[model samples]
Target: MDLDSQALNMSSRADLVEFLGGLADSFATHPERWQNANLPDFLNAWAAWLEDMDGYFQNRGESVPTSASWQLIAQMLLAARVYE
Candidate 1:
């Protein structure tokens, strides 16, 4: 899938939240693998980035991309081996 296009197409926060939840579940089920992959550090950085985005949106009274966007971004990063 063209993640850039897919990310632009996301229109709902709920959908994003669902997607993130699924990604989190995937990670949860394979703790050892994720840890070995250093996914925890990546996740922590991602979380911090999200917090910054959230704060930015809050300050501007603008909407942030839903968790779905984050999920898609995470997937794209994985696909690109950015985490590695």
Candidate 2:
């Protein structure tokens, strides 16, 4: 299998962090949808982490994008790379 042949552009690290932030806000307004949704382990873990970070940011009086956010973004990119 040619790795390059299957490679494609994905969201950038910054974009992913921003997206997570938006998702956090959305989750706050509609937690009911997630109660019964069957999400993959990876996705569920990511959502939990995002929720935690969102709360942390709010409590600490910090910025939106934190180190954990960047780290998670990199981790997702690396996981996707391995499947390629």
The best candidate in terms of lDDT: 1
**lDDT of each residue in 1-84, candidate 2, tens digit only:** 122222223246565456556556656777675653444755677778766877767787977664445676567767977774
lDDT, each prediction:
0.65, 0.59
lDDT of 1 by residue, 1-84 (tens): 233454556567665556666656766776664543566787687688777887877787978757445577767667867544
Total clashing residue pairs per candidate? 2, 0
Local error of candidate 2 at 62, Å? 40
Q: Estimate each model's TM-score.
A: 0.35, 0.32
- List where candidate 2 sits over 4 angstroms from the true fold: 1-10, 36-84
